[model samples]
Target chain A: MSTLTSPDVGRRTTGRRGAVARVLAAPLVVAVLGLVTLLWLQSIELDSIEKRTLNTDYLVDRVREHLLLSLSAAALVALLAIPAGVLIHRTNSRVLRGVVLALANIGQATPAVGVVILLAIVWRTGFTTALVALVAYSFLPVLRNTLTGLAEVDPATREAARGMGMTRTQVLRRIELPLASPVILAGLRTSLVFAVGVATIATFINAGGLGDMIVNGLKLQRYPVLIVGAALVAGIAILIDWVAGLVEEYARPRGL
Target chain B: MPKPTTIIFPSMDVRGAASGGSATSGGGVSIELDSVTKTYPGQDVSAVEDFSMRIEPGELVMFVGPSGCGKTTTMKMVNRIIEPTSGSIRIDGQDVLSLSPDQLRRHIGYVIQQIGLFPHMTIADNIATVPRLLGWSKKETSARVEELLDTVQLDPAVFADRYPRQLSGGQQQRAGVARALAADPPVMLMDEPFGATDPITREKLQAEFLRLQADIGKTIIFVTHDFDEAVRLGDRIAVLSERSQIEQFDTPAAILAAPANDYVASFIGSGAALKRLSLMPVTSADLSFGAPASGGKRPQLDPTATLRDALDLLVVTGAEALEIVDADGTRLGCLTHAAISAALTQSSPTRGAGPAAGEGVHR
Candidate 1:
């Protein structure tokens, strides 16, 4: 009897070790890619146009601008969409929930570049338009996650909390939220990564970012600049996702 | 297995000597529902209509019926989980509707079939929910958590820090009960608290719950669709029909011996005689000190064992009689099928004689 169960224990130990390796693998791969890009750029001689965009100062500024746009938009979505999702969930109104969810669906369904360009066309081109467009594009995942996370709490668990004399608010704060955190965090992680990708479109409206390098390289036919810009953005996306993954792991309630 | 020979024996008078009593630990209070009725809006039929009953202090009354019988609705009203459309529910003579629903619930223990231990919280935190709600000190709450885990037979050191998912179904159920009893409330409302477990686990849980109730003696309203569960665990089984109508409310032995109507009899189902044997101890029968049969050793039963257990042992061993032993394993007497039958027949008169007759034998 004991021997029959021993393999399960061995498998479980190996599975845990595999999970640790998986967690570390993303950053390791991104680091190597970043190093390779740096080495390739160092080896290649750049023309005047490529040199202009490929310098450390310009590259850093574009990366800074890119980070500012994506991070702010993700932050804004987190602040607004989550509470709104919660409020809609608490109201428990079918019509209200349905309407909000439908609007969220439309917001997400619209292409990211289309949203950014449409907003810039309608309301002057600049950083603000890109921010709003990014927020709009990424809003649905966090909002939908919050609503679904709250909705999917076990009814029996909800009832048990209420049955134990917890007020509705107490139930949400003490029981529902903690149980829903994993799914909610997953949604936030998705939106953050999405914001980084969508922020690339910011360069179209003269909003400064790595996108500028890619666009300038493409228009001027400097493949080195384009490669550098595209490589940097991809690296940023992966790194941001890795950091978010760490936060998610640390913040998740134990025993879930 | 040999087909045992049948033995005839004279009937013995064991009426008024059955096992039913309301000895309490003084932690429970009386609950009264006067003309309680609940009608959900837009639904013409009432879920529970004009339901009224008086539950004595420390009594475990079971509301037993088929599904959709409104039994659960009736119990939920006591804690105001589902407020009554029109009725006065009093706990220890205080009107429950007057108190804030949350405050009212804090004082009433509640458990359900789902065994809803919070998945994210440790067992200690789950058990401490009510205590924290009532503003108990952390030290006091932790101590109480430790005590309750021990009470439910879960080792406090081992289980207190474990999450709900880490526990087996039976352990989770124990945690659910421990969580409910955390604040030491005077009244408990249970809705099929053991219904979700497998049969063997359910039986073990039932026995543990019975032992727990005896020590704490909180006036409990336990609801279940399983009639055998009702008979085994209830101090008084309230057979409910549709609309939460009380068909009969009396001791399990009384209900088993004498069902008030066909509805209750139907709820009792078949083999009630065998069910009644469960309520009676082996000592209730007039055990003979006759010599054992010419064979190897026969199966032995404890004196505290029930007549049903005695019957089971006899059938399993295929013996005409079994020896009843004391704590030291010394044979007290021989228990036979005839003695078990006599005990059942003697207790059968209280049947159909109504709740009063049942209560007499029960007390």
Candidate 2:
């Protein structure tokens, strides 16, 4: 019996260790990638690439612009998607929910590049058009995740809250939303990463980002610039994903 | 397994203990339902029809019936969880319909079989839900949570900060009960609150629940399909049938002795005599048989044990009689199988009265 009980204790200790390792693993990988990128850039003789892409002023400006566009689009998507999902969930009419879900599906089903090009044609290409296209592209995941999170809350818990005299708003605020936080954050994380990847297309309309380097490098046949530009974009994506992971860990409900 | 060195009996005279316990903080209001009926839309028959009963303050009345018999519907209507098609409900002589549903529920405690403890919340936070809703101070709410944890026989130190998943089924159910009792509501509605626990755990919870009720004395309407549970905890049972119609309503002993109809008799099944033995305390039976048997060892029975337990002990020990003793180990009297049988067969009108066993007779 003592032996039988000992394994459970061992498993619990290992489980905690596993969680800690998971939290550390993402940032460690990103750090290693950053060090490799720096060393590889140093080893290669690419003075031309260094002047245009690796310079402090050029890299910082492009990276800042990339981050600004992606963060804005993600914020907008969250604002729209979460409430839409909640409204769809709270409404009793099947037709209404069906209609909203159908629209979301259509938005996601359409190709992202097509959405960006179409917006560029009609609304004019630039940061604004790119932001709008990114928001539309990122909407589905956030909305779907929000709906799933709210739906996943145990019905018995909702009934108990109501029976305990909580108003509708109180139930949503104190119980439902807190329980749904981790999933919602996961949705936001996906949207943010998608937005970062999609923002690369904004350079086609001269929005000025690492994408500018890639498009220019391609046109000018500068392989060194192209490599650094592509590497930087990948690096930013990984960095943002790591940051979102931290947010998710912090936002996860305790004592669950 | 280690052999037991001591036997702790179930509390005797639960009613007296309950009444005494409620004296310090008294707040129970009588409830009366007048010809209550509920019929769902498009349904041919009403779910519950012409349901009416008076529940005295601080009493635990169990609604016992088969599934889909509308026992839950009737109870829900009291807190307006369900609206009755007809009839009025009054708590403390005030019409329940006059108050808003949320307002009415604030004063009524509800516990369900699923336990429904919020997975995101700590045990203390779960218990503090209603108190916080009612705008109690943080200090007051925390104190109440601790008090309730203790009341349900859970340690506040070990459980307050823990999550519901950290607890066993029995512990979770206890926390559920504690949550219901948090705001000290005068009335509590329990829908098979311990139906999910295993047999051993359920028995322990039932015993603990009885002691808790004995202390708090809240007016409780408990719904369950288990007759044994109803008999163990209810002061009176309302046996309902299809469409929430009342078949028989009476004390467990009264129902066991004389079932109102064949339906009730069938529901009771067999072994009612043995069931009745559980209702009366061992002291209630005449245990005045003269002296213990000389020289030979005999089994001991606690005075707090029921007559049914005494009968089983006599058979198990293969003795004509056993000595009944109090907590102090002092011999009270001898309990014989004949006395238990006589007590079971007797039909005395006085409440809890039983047959008196005669003095010593050699086996």
Interface RMSD after interface superposition, each candidate: 8.6, 8.8
Instruction: Return the lDDT, model 1, position B173.
Output: 92
Name model 2 segments beyond 4 Å from true: A1-21, A35-54, B1-24, B286-298, B325-333, B348-363
lDDT of 2 by residue, A1-256 (tens): 0010111211223377788887787778777877887787788777654466668888889999999999999999999999988888788567886787789899989988788888898889788988898999999889989988998899899989989988888889889888888899999999999999889888877676778878878988877678778887888888889889988876677655
Model 1 chain A weakest 10-residue run by lDDT? A1-10
lDDT of candidate 2 over B1-363, digit per residue (tens):
121111111121222111223222544668889999999999999999999999998889999999999999999998888998999998878788877787678678899999999887778888888777766656766777777888888898888877788899999999999998776677899999999999999999998898788777888999999998988898888899998888888777777777778888888888887777887777767788768647866789888788878888888879988898888989999878877877766643343233213111100
lDDT of 1 by residue, B261-361 (tens): 99999888899888888778888887875867576577889988888899999898898888899999787898888888887777675554543222222
Could you tell me which 10 consecutive residues in candidate 1 chain B have the lowest summed lDDT? B4-13
lDDT value, residue A13 of candidate 2: 37
Q: Give every collision pair in model 2.
A: B18-B214
Q: Say which candidate scores most in TM-score.
A: 1
Candidate 2 overall lDDT versus native: 0.80
TM-score of each: 0.89, 0.87
Interface RMSD for candidate 1 relative to the native interface: 8.6
Q: For candidate 1, give the lDDT of residue B313.
A: 90
TM-score of model number 1: 0.89
